[model samples]
Target: MSKWTEIRDGMVSALDVSDVVESAKDQLITDLTGDGMDALSTVADKFITQVQVQAESEQGWCMVRDKFVLPLMINGILWAVKLVLAKSTPATATQPEAPTGDSQQ
Candidate 1:
């Protein structure tokens, strides 16, 4: 496989693992009470913040794509997936509403 393919696969795997880990942490918090829940929440928050920082880093984007465009595209795809799975009704097709007032030049 190509290097890019390998990198993509690795990233997906990492994301999956992160999801699982977060779930497990959540479960632990649910199963515990008081201090345990607070501790787990603190750790989870730190982990999430670290991941976000890494994801938004300039070097992180450049290491994969010379430009940051690819990451934005990937983010868009993930957003679409969430929209597809969400419980709300799918958006209805509608005509664009014309300007209610006079159009600006």
Candidate 2:
């Protein structure tokens, strides 16, 4: 095998993406749904609740403001989803944070 191939395979073997994916999926699924309901279903339920709540809020957003606000709302949801996934997956399964050396007085 080529050196690059060996390095790529070693990297892949070191990280079990399936474990991280499964763990993150499991967490997004709330127990709000009883047995027999799968993770996707629970994720959808939570997603709907978040959007519905924001839509129902008294934002006083007019057509001009909504053009900007709608996208911001979607961005907010994306941030929330990523945060949950990061929390669900083990620290070792994800990339390590870069070091910020040196202290400021």
Candidate 3:
């Protein structure tokens, strides 16, 4: 077999062994702690809820902005201004019409 083939096989074997070792470690931890999957799941749930609440609070515009309405109005006006500018800008002039000529004599 080629050296390359041998190397590929060795890498695959190593990955398989690593996976087994990690699985065993997780099982050992679960068994020793007795917290098992249920405890882990509850912690995960609380973490998710806290993250959601924090995200919502942070995203509340009124809390951060003194004049939230003004900012939204300004944004709308800017968007409209951009749209008008884009519409008024002339497009590149069309290519000059090709001369009318019969291709086949």
Q: Which numbered prediction scores highest in lDDT against the true structure?
A: 2
lDDT of 1 by residue, 5-105 (tens): 99999988878754566556544434444454456556655654555566555576454552445545655655564444332322231235667787677
Instruction: Give all TM-scores, in the order shown.
Output: 0.26, 0.32, 0.26
lDDT of 3: 0.54
Model 3 worst lDDT window (10 residues): 85-94
lDDT of each: 0.53, 0.58, 0.54
Q: Per-residue alpha-carbon lDDT of model 3 for 2-83, expressed as tens digits?
A: 9999999999987885456655654555453344434544654565455545554565664334234444554565556555
Q: Could you tell me which 10 consecutive residues in candidate 2 have the lowest summed lDDT?
A: 28-37
Tens-digit lDDT track for model 2 on 1-105? 999999999999989676676555555443312232345446655765565566655465554344455556755765676566556555554668777876566
lDDT of 3 at 81: 50
Q: Enumerate clash totals for all models, in the order shown.
A: 0, 0, 0
Point out where model 1 deviates above 4 Å: 1-31, 58-105
